[model samples]
Target chain A: MLSKNTVKFIKTLHQKKYRNLEQKFFVEGEKSVLELLNSDFEVELLLVTERFFEQHQKQLNHLRAELLIVTQKQLESVGQFQSNDSALAVAKMKSNQYFENTQEDLVIALDDVRDPGNLGTIIRIADWYGIKHLLFSSQTAEFYNPKVIQASMGSFTRVKFYYGDLKEIFKKWDCPIYGAYLGGSNIHQLNKPKPGILLMGNESNGISEELAGFVTNKITIPGFGSAESLNVAIATAILCDNFKRLAGE
Target chain B: MLSKNTVKFIKTLHQKKYRNLEQKFFVEGEKSVLELLNSDFEVELLLVTERFFEQHQKQLNHLRAELLIVTQKQLESVGQFQSNDSALAVAKMKSNQYFENTQEDLVIALDDVRDPGNLGTIIRIADWYGIKHLLFSSQTAEFYNPKVIQASMGSFTRVKFYYGDLKEIFKKWDCPIYGAYLGGSNIHQLNKPKPGILLMGNESNGISEELAGFVTNKITIPGFGSAESLNVAIATAILCDNFKRLAGE
Candidate 1:
C-alpha cells in the first residue's frame, strides 16, 4: 500500500525538474530493479508486486531500503509502465562526476544525442565495447529518463555518464579525438586506430562546429547502400566495434 | 480544408485493421512524403501546407494524386503528427510479395521482432547495407504500422519485406544461413564468410528453436564490455557491415 503523497512523489520523479530537485530517479521492471539493488547506487524505496517479492526472497532479505510489497494495480498507478508486474525502485543518484582520469582507455563523447532511446542504446553499446566513460553535451537527453534507462536494459548500472560542456572538455583533452563524419577516413582502412575519445554528434546534425576543431581525426563508417545515414546508436556501436577490434581491448 | 468524411477516413488509416482493409497507409514529414512521391509507389492523396506547396511546386506539378493545400491545423488532425508543417501523403500499398528470387545478394530474415521501432530500424538497416529483401516470421509486427514507417524514414520504399513461415522457407534455402547468437563464430574471424540469410530473432527470445537447425553458421559480435545483448537493429547493422565487408558486394 502507498500513501497519496508517496505515489505523487514517485510520479513527479518522472520529470527532470523533480528528479533533479530530489536527486533521485526511478528504476522499473524486474531486471532493472534487481540491477539497482545489486549496484553500488543507493536504493531509497522499492515497490514490488507479490510475484516479484516471492521470486527474489533471498535477495530481498538483505535490502536496506523500505520495501513495500504493493499490489500490481498500485504499482502501475505510480509507475510509467502500463502493466508492471515486477518492481519499481526509487534510487539515489550518484554524484561521482569529474572522472577526468579514468582507467578505461576509450571514452565515448556524445554531442546533442536528443533521443532518449538512442542515448540508452548508446549506453548499452558502450557497456558492450567495454568503454566505461560517456561524456554528453548538455543538450543530450537526460540519462536518468525512464525510456533511456529501460532501453539500456541493465547496462545503465555498468556505464558511467556525465553531462557537461564538450567544447571546453575536448579543448583540454590529451588523447586523439576521433569524430564520426560523412566523408572522413573509411573506418575499414584505418591501421588499428589508437584508443582515444570517440565523439558522436546529433541525430540530424553531425558534430557541431564548436567541437569540430578539437577532432584530431575524422572517421566514418562507410555505407554500402542508399540510406542517408545510420541511427546514432547504431553508428556508435559500429564505430565501437571497429575501435575495439583495433584496440583489442 | 478537409471534409468530415476525409478526416474520418484518414483517422481510420491509423489502425492496422482499417489500413489492411483500405490497402493504403500514411507517410508524414517532408522527407518521407517527398520520397513516397518520387518512388514507384502510387500516391492516393497528398495534403500539404501553403509553405510546402510553394516550396515543392515543381514536384507537386507532376503528382497525379488529389492534392489538397491543407492548413497546418487541419494537417495535424488528419495525421499522426502533432504539428506537421510540410506534407502528409496517403500512399497506395504495393503488394509485390512473391520475391523468393530477388537480385540482392543478402537478405535479412526477422523472427518475431515485435517492436515497430525495431522492425523500422531493421528496414532502414537493410536499405543501408544494400540488402533489399526482408523475410519476417508471421509473428513479427506489421511493417506498415505508422511508427515503423515513420522510423524507417522512407526506407520502406526501397526495402522489400515478406512475412512467412521460416521453418518451411529454410528447408529450401540454397545459400548460407547466418544466425546471430551468444555463442558463435567471432564475426571478425570469419574469412569473408558467404552471404545467405541473416536471421535475427525476437527482441527477448532470440532466433526460434525451430529455425536453429537450419543455421549454417552461428555468428556473434565480439563484446569487450558487459552488455548482455545488442538491440536487434544495432546488431543487424554490425552484422551487415561485416557481411558486406566480406562479400565485398
Candidate 2:
C-alpha cells in the first residue's frame, strides 16, 4: 500500500540525471539491501515486506532509516529487480573523491568502459582482489546506475569509485601504468608485477590514443583460440589475478 | 520488408521449444551475422539492409541462403538486438553431440549454470583460451538463447556445446576432474595443471554436492576482500588462464 508519490520518487532514482540532482540512489533485492544497511552509507529509507521485517527484526533494531512495510508487488513495481520479495533502500551518494595512491597500492583505472553491467562486474572483481579504489574516465558509466549496483552483488559496499579525466590523474601518479592491449607482452610470462594502475579500455575500442600515451607498460592475456577479445570484465579479472599473483611472489 | 509470417517464425526461435522443434536460431548484430556467414553451419535466411548488402557484396557473393533486403526497423522488430542496422541470420542448430576427451584435451563442464548471459560469456572465454568443447548439465541454459548468442560475441561459431547428465559423462572419462570451490587449493600455486575437465557450478550455488564427489582436484581463486564469490563467467576465465599458463610453462 505505497503512496503514488512515493513510488514516483523511487522510480526517479533509476535515471542518472535525477540521481545526480538529488545526490541519491536506490538499492534493490534482499542481499543488497542487507549490505546497504550494514554499510557506512547513510540510508534514507528502507522499504521491506512484512516477511522480511519479521525475519530480520534483530538487524532492523537500532536502524536509523525510516522503515515502511510494503507488499512484494509494491517492491517489484518500483525497483529494477523483477522480483524483490524482501527490501529496497534509498541511500545518499558519497561526494566524489580521487584516490591518493601509495607505493603499496594497486589502483584500477578504466578508459571509458561504458557498459553498466561491465562496470558492476568489475567492481565485484575489484572487491574480490582487495582493490579499494577504482578510477574511471569521465565517460564511464555512472556508479549509481542500478544495473551496476545489481551486477556488483554486494561488493559495491566495499569498493570506492572516482570518476574524472584519466589522463589528468595518470599524469600525477609515479608508479608504472599497466595498460591492457591486444599485442602486449604475455601477462603470464611477465616479471614480477609492481603495484600500479591497471588500465582497461572501452567495450569495443581499446584504450584511447591519449590514454595510450601515458601507459608505462603494455600487457595482454594471451589467447589460444579465435575470440576477437575478452569481455572487459572478464579481462579485468584475469589481469587482476595475474597482478596479485605476480606481486605476491 | 519481411512477411508477417516470416517475422513471426523468427520471433518463435527466441524460445527453446520452437528452436528445438525447428532446429534453428537467429543471430543478430553485424559482427555475429558476419561470423555466421563465414561459419560452417547452414544458414536459412539472411535479412540485410540495402546499405549492408551494398557494402558487403563481395562477402555476400556466392551466398546460398535466401537473401532479403529489410529495413533496420524490421530487423529490430524480429531480433533480440535493440538496434541492428547491418544484418540478421537464421541458422541451423548443430546436432547435439558429446565430446570424446582425448588425453591432451582440457574440457570445461558446468553444473546447472543457468543464466543465458553467463553461458554466453563463458563460451567467449572458452574460445579465447582455445577450449573447443563445453559440457553442461541438463539444467543449464540452452545454447541457442539469443542472449547467449549475442553475449558470446562471435565465439559461438568456434566453440561446441554438449548437454546431458554430468554424472553419467564424468563416469566415462578417465582424466582428472578439477572442481572450482570457495575453499580449496590455491589455483595460482597448483602444480602445473594437467589436461582435464574443469567444472564450474551454478551462479548462487558452488559446485553441486553430488558433482563434488567426482572431482580429483578442488581448486579456488583466492580472494583478499569481502565479496562473497566471483561471477561464474569471470571465475571461469581466471581458471582457464591459470590452467593454460601453467600447462604451457
True contacts kept of each: 0.87, 0.97
lDDT of 1 by residue, A1-249 (tens): 688989999999999999999999999899888888888889989999989999999999989999898998888889888879999999989884867835347899999999999999999999988889989999999999999999898889997778899887877777889999998998876886767899999999999999999999999888877889888899998888888777755
Q: Residue B77 deviation, candidate 2, in Å?
A: 1.4
Q: In candidate 1 chain A, where is summed lDDT lowest over 10 consecutive residues? A: A96-105
Cand. 1 TM to true fold: 0.98
**Model 2 accuracy (lDDT, Cα):** 0.92
What TM-score does each of the candidates earn?
0.98, 0.98
lDDT of 2 at A160: 78
> How would you encode candidate 1's per-residue C-alpha lDDT over B136-234 as one tens digit per residue?
899999988999998898899898777888888888778888999989999977887766899998999999889999999999999987788999999
Regions of candidate 2 where Cα sits further than 4 Å from its true position? none
